[model samples]
Target: MISETMESHKKDSPSDIKCGIITLSDSLKEKGNEGIEEDLSGQYLFERLSEKYEVSAYVLIADESDKLIQAISNMNSKGIDVIFTTGGTGLESRDITIETLVPRFDKVILGFGEEFRRKSFEKLGSGALLSRSTAGIYNKTIIFALPGSPNAVEMGLNLIYPEIGHLVKHARK
Candidate 1:
C-alpha cells in the first residue's frame, strides 16, 4: 500500500497517475542471501512521479517466464494505473519478459520500443538495438518493459513518465 501522505499529496493533483514498479532478474530473486546490487531506476522514477501521482506498489522478481507472467497478471488484477518493469529486456536466453507479457497486453505501444532505442542509441551506440523495450495496455493498466540496466531505466522513465498520467486516465475511461 502507498502511504497516506503520498496519496493525499496526489489527490486532486494535476497528474492523477498511479504506478507500480517491478524489477526482473534471475539472481536477484534467487540466491537467498544475495542482495539486488543494481540500482533500481524504476524506484527513482517512482519517487519523482510520487510528487504528483500515487505509487501503488514496488515488486522484484526473478527472470523465469512463469514468475514474470504471474507477477504482471497480479499487478493488473490489482487495478494499477501503470506498471514499469525494469530488466530482462535483453537477448539472453533467460530474457523472456517480453514473451510472457505479449499475450497479456490489450494493445502494443510499438513506438515505445522505437523511441527507447533511439534515445538509448545516443548514449550506447549500436548496443541499443539489442534492447527489446516495449509498452502496452493490459487490463486497463499501462505496462512498460524497460532494459535491465539502470541507465536504460532512466531513459525509459524520462520519456514515458510525462505522458503516463494522461495515458492512465484515458485507459480507465
Candidate 2:
C-alpha cells in the first residue's frame, strides 16, 4: 500500500495515461482467458488504473519467449505508455519472461525488482527472493514482468502502478 504522503503527492499532478495489461501463461492462452484468480487480479489492477488513466489494451498469452516478444512489440507499436505482464517470472526453466524482455529494453528499471522483493519480504520472508519480478523500458514503453501468483500480481500492482505514469512520462522526454 502507498503511504498517505505518497498518495497525496500524486493528487497535484496525475497524468491521464494509457496502459496495457498482459497475462503470460500457457493455460490462459489455451483456455482463452486468465483463470479466476488471475482474472480477478487483472480486473483489480485494471479498475484501479482506470481510475487514474485508461487501460488501452489487454492480452493473455502463453509463456513462450517469441510470443512474449511479439506481444510486447505489438503493444509498443500501438503507443501504449506501459505494459504490465503477470506470470512466468520465476527460476523455472520455462520462466523466460525476463529473458524475452531483456533484449527489447532500452533501460532496465533494476530498482523495481529490488524494491518489490524487499517489500514482499516484509510479508513472505525469504520466499520473496524467488520472484523474478522486473521492470524496464522498451521503445518508450514501460514494461513490468511480475510473478504468476495472484498475490504477487497484487503486490506489484499496489507497489508499482503508482509510479507508472511518472516513469512513462520521463521516458518519453
Candidate 3:
C-alpha cells in the first residue's frame, strides 16, 4: 500500500506549495531589542525548503501560547501552503506549541507522530517516545511541528518534506 501510494504521489502532487517556518524557543527569541541568536533548526528548514518550494516567511518566537497562536494565524492568513515549526513540543511548562496548535487542526495527521517516534527510536533509543512532534491541516495550510533539536529537526524534515506537496494536495481536496 505504501509503495503504491508513493508511486502514485510521485506524478500528481502539487509542486508549487509555498512554505513558512517558525522556530519556537525562549532562548533563541530576542529579548527586548537584543538581537536573537541563530536558530539552527529554522535555518535548516529554510535551506532545505528553499531548494524546492517558495519560502514565504520565517519567524523565531518564544514558546508562548498566545504568540505562537498568533503566528500560526498570520501564516495561514498569508495563504501559506505549509508552516513548519520547531520547538515547544515537550513537557516543560513553557512548551506550548503542540498545545496551541492541536485544537486548531482541521485534521490531525496521527501517523506523523507515530512515524516520527519510530524513526527517532532508531537513532535515539527509547527516549524518542517523549517527543510530541506532529503534523496537521489548519484551514488551507498544513503545519508540521517538530522538536527543537537540530538532529530531530533533520529527521523530521527528511520524513515530511518529500510528502509535503502530497499532503497539501489532499488537504485542498
Candidate 4:
C-alpha cells in the first residue's frame, strides 16, 4: 500500500523542479586565497542535481547569518523548488548554517536530520554527532543544510534526491 502511494506521487510529481545551490564558507569567500580551489560540494551537487533537475542558481558566500538569510530569501523569491546549502553545519563557532536557516523554516523536516545523523554515524563513527545537518521548508521552498565536506554533501544529497520530487510536490500544494 505504501509503495502504491509512493508510485502515485511519483507519477504526479513535476519533472522540471528548479534547484539552487549555495556554499557558505568564510574561506571560500576570501578574495586572495590562492590555495582555495573550486567548491567541490557545490559542484558535485550541481552535477548530480542537473542530471534530474534544473539548477537555477549557484553562489558561494561567507558564514554570516545575514548573508545566508538574504541568499535564502532571494532564492525563495525566485521561485526555486529546492535549495541545497553546503557548509557551516558543524559545532564550531563559525558553523551557523542551521542556526541561520531554522527560524526561516515554515515546517522543519525533523526526520531528515535524524536519518542523516544515523547514516553518517555508520560511516563517520561518533564524529557524526558534531554535524547539525538538517532540512525544512521555507515559504514553499525546500531547503537542505549540509556539512562542508564533499562526502557529507554527497551523503545528504543521496538521501534526499529520491524523495525531493515528492516533497516538492507536497510543499507546492
Tell me, by TM-score, which candidate is best.
4
Q: How accurate is candidate 3 locally (lDDT)?
A: 0.88
Every candidate's lDDT:
0.77, 0.80, 0.88, 0.90
lDDT of 3 by residue, 66-135 (tens): 8898888998898899999999999889899999999999999998999999999998899988899998
Worst window of 10 by summed lDDT in candidate 4: 28-37
Over 4 Å off, model 2 = 1-14, 33-38
Model 4, 58-120: lDDT tens digits are: 888999999999898898899999999999988889988988999889999999999999999
Global CA lDDT computed for model 4? 0.90
Candidate 1 lDDT over 78-165, as tens digits, reads: 7778888888888889888888888889989888889988988888899877989999988888899987787778778889866665
- Alpha-carbon deviation at 137 in model 2, angstroms: 0.6
Error of 1 at 86 (Å): 0.7
TM-scores, one per candidate: 0.83, 0.86, 0.93, 0.94
- Tens digits of per-residue lDDT, candidate 2, 55-170, equal 89878778898888888888888889888888788888888898898777889999999999998899899888797788999988899888877787888888876677667657
Better-scoring candidate (lDDT), 1 or 4: 4
Collision pairs in model 2:
none
Ten residues in a row with the worst lDDT in model 2? 33-42
The regions of model 1 sitting more than 4 angstroms off are 1-14, 31-39
